[model samples]
Target chain A: MYKFLTTFLPKPLANIAMALWYFLLIIMNLYCGIAFAQGTFQYVGW
Target chain B: MRLLIEAILFAIPMILLAWTLPKKYVLLSQIIITALFIAYQSPLSFAILGTITFGNYYLLHKAVLRKSIKFVISLGILVLLIVSAKILFTIHDHWIIPLGMSYYIFRNIHYTIESYNGRIQNESLLFYLAYNFFLPVLIIGPINRYPEFIRDWQRRRVNSEYFSLGFQRILYGFSKIMIIGSYILSLKLSAIISNIDESKHWLKVYLETITVVLNAYFQFAGYSDIAIGISLLLGFRVMENFNFPFLASNMQEFWSKYHMSLTSFCRDYIYTPLASYFRRPMLGVFITMIIIALWHEITLPFLIWGSLQAFGIYLAFIFKDTPTSLVSKNLGRVFVFNYFCLSCVIIDYELAEALDIYKTLFFIN
Candidate 1:
């Protein structure tokens, strides 16, 4: 799927875009973790 | 959570100072910053870390030069510290687990073991303190090895590309924690799971299991990303803790991708040594997982979770030699994912409660 999405772009551009995609994915996870920790919500394991 | 906020507030000024200061003073500034940060967390934390830094330095100093019983004695002292700390945390309600105790203990042990085998040669007191108390990964860590961390520190670089990418990673981590982790799972799935006895819906049980897995991933990997990003901003490189673990097709692959640092640490420090000592890979695997499990928490459920994980790993190892069709591979992926989810549920709940949910999922209740 990733290959298909990047097939059209030049190699460098594709690499950069892939990097950005991964970056955002991590940021999203980090944001959720922080918010969860700060919130008064109950969670399972620490 | 408050620790994280305090870390950031504490780090900003130190970061600026390190960035603007003369090169020779950077290490000293980092040491001071780390000392102050740990002190701010708790005076006890400050004293504890100070003691640990000085103690490990002295022990490793003596241990690294030997190939005799004294080496054993030195290693024993370090292990004793970890074991006593774990025991004290369990038996005493008043014991605060000394900020970063788990992380730095593993780190000190790693250093001791690595240095014993001639993997690291540095004996610098300043570098040792700075490496272990590195503000970014001090609390939650990717667990950088002493040599690798020092190597990065010595040749630190702060280019615009690294700066932008580092900030980008930090933001991505925050998004994972605040948005996907909280909104998608904590608020919804946790609420549903807490009320599962009343619901008794198989689908909700399944969803809860899935959310448990996702929440664990986001929470851990998110912290790792933030840690790695902050390390990058500081012009030091910390190892990546997670890959795209959920996409992994088997337990072995999953273990390798998930918590890469800890897994590798166990592999290198525990599994390899024990396997050689005992001449049995399976025994080594079992012992390693047991240690890993116990490392997470001193509880019955964690032990069970570790046993389950070790079982999964053993199963994967057995199946590695078997030829599988594409269908089998897909089935394996599903099986592995579900197995992990169920085991995670076990970790979160009492055995009876967990089994009840499992029975409902199987339509037996």
Candidate 2:
């Protein structure tokens, strides 16, 4: 699946696309971290 | 969580300073910063860590020059400290946190072993303290080796690409922890697994088992990612911990992929030596897994889980010689995943209770 996606998109373009996805992930994580910090965001390990 | 805040508020400025500081002063600055962080956490803990650092340093410093029985004696002392700390601190008992005791002990032991083998070149007390207590990796470590860490410290960089990538990695790790690990896994799914007896349906049982196992993975992997990312930002190239472990096609591949550093540590430090001594890789594999398991938590359930893991790995080793087909490959993936999921019950439950859960998972109850 990853190979197919990369094959369809050019190398540099694919890199950009992946980087954008990570950027979105960062935004989502930041929102979650702040919103859930007071509620459910507890680390699950020692 | 408070530690995370402390890191952002306090450690980041020091990291930036250390990055821009002269090469010679960088290590000293980091050492002082890390020491202050530990001291701020607790003065007693700081004292304990200081004693450990001095003891390990003195022993290693002496052993290399003397070439006498100090090596064995130092190793024995470190092992004793580890055992005592393990017994003293249990999360369930709430006796003492033993803040970073496990990680620092292992780090010092690694330093001691490498020193005994003459693998380490610089035996500077400051560098040793800095490496062992490097504030970022101290909490959840990829267990960076002393030699590798020092090498990175000497030639650390702060290029645009590295800084950008490091920032992205940190964000990614935080996302994994906040979104998936804590919210989805812990809040939503683990709540169900904690009440497993409420469900009689096989599907629910399977779902709970898989959720619990994934919870364990995400929790640890998320922390590891954050630790590694933090280290990267601090201009250290710590080892990778997890590598798409859930996608592993076999148990051998799983171990090689999951917690790669710990696996390699076991391989290099424990398995290789034991295999050489016993002249059998199989026994070495069992012993290594048992040691790793007991190291996590000294209990009967962990022992059983470790044995199951060893068995899975052995099967993978045996199957490697056989002719492969796509069906067999997929089957191998299923077996490995299911084995790990089943074994993870030991993390939270006792032997009998975990066995009951297994029976439910198999629809035998």
Candidate 3:
């Protein structure tokens, strides 16, 4: 999967895709973090 | 929230210190940060951890220097007794087991065994302490080895590649925990299952069983990813814990890929020695499985779960030499996957509840 991304896509396009992916992850993390603080999200214990 | 907040707050300064300090002082910064974090979280646990760390270090040093079998045996038994006490205390709710006690003890056990074999190079008490209490792996671990960690420390360097990769890996870990495990598996799939009709009891049972196992995998693998990623950021390359375990086509393959560190530890320290001692490989397999089960919790369900896993591996061994085609390989994957999912019911529920689920799954009625 990594090879396909780095090899198949243009460097600039790959960079943009990577940045967007991180952005999406950060936004989702923020949402989950807030939900967790509000006691709506269940905790997964070790 | 408190734990998360504290971890982030501590991690920021810890990472900064690690980057700014001389390579030699990096381990010291980690030790201090870990001490602060544990003390802040629970003072009693902090005290307990400190005692264990220092005591084990003293014992290990003596064992290594004297090369005495007696010292090795005594130290091994002492650690086991502490772990057993922790298990019993957990069962009775009489006392709280110090956080990360399980992970660190296994590490201590690994260290002891290796030291006895004269494989350990760095006998530095400082390195041992840092290995035990390294913040990322202290809670949930890949159980990084002593030799590898020492090597990483010696060759540690500042690099942009490590930073980028570490950040990316951490993001992947959070995504697995938050989106995949918590939201999709725990909340959404569970809600869907609960809404199903009672008439489709078998379907509900199957789906719920699969979901439980998958959720466990994601939760564990996510924590491991976070731990490994943090280790990477510190310029240390720790062992990988999971490698697409669900894709494995047999019980042996699955065990090899899933929780790679712990299983490999068992293979090396538990299974190998026992197998050689008894001269009966199957007996060793059973005992190792039991130890693995007891490591999690000394409960009847866990014992049964471990036995079932051993039996699965035994069957796989019997068929080891059988010829395989593409169709057979796919079938094997499906069979192994379902077998694991169903067996997980034993550990996830009470005995009678698990029995009922099995009956429902197999159409016993």
Number of the top-ranking candidate, with lDDT as the measure: 3
Give the per-residue Cα lDDT of candidate 3 at B9.
71
Candidate 3 lDDT by residue in tens digits, B1-365 = 24545665787788888899987788999999999999988898788788877887777675455567545664667567666775787578767677777787788888877877889989999999888878888876788899999998888888899898888878888788888888789888999999999998889889999988898999888878887888888888899999998888899898999899989999998899999999988888899888888888878888899999899889888999999889888999999999999988999988999999999988898
Clash statistics: count for each candidate: 28, 0, 0
DockQ of 1: 0.32
* CAPRI quality of model 1: acceptable
Cα-based TM-score, every candidate: 0.87, 0.90, 0.94
Q: After superposition, how far is residue B189 of candidate 2 from its true place, in Å?
A: 5.0
RMSD (Å) of each candidate, 1 decimal: 3.8, 3.0, 2.0
Supply candidate 2's per-residue lDDT for B325.
84
Docking class of 3: medium
User: What is the total number of backbone clashes in candidate 1?
Assistant: 28
Stretches off by above 4 angstroms in model 1 are: A1-46, B62-70, B188-200
> Which regions of candidate 3 fall more than 4 Å away from where they truly are?
A44-46, B1-5, B62-65
Worst 10 residues of 1 chain B by lDDT: B62-71
Return the candidate ranking by TM-score, descending. 3, 2, 1
Better of 1 and 2 by lDDT: 1
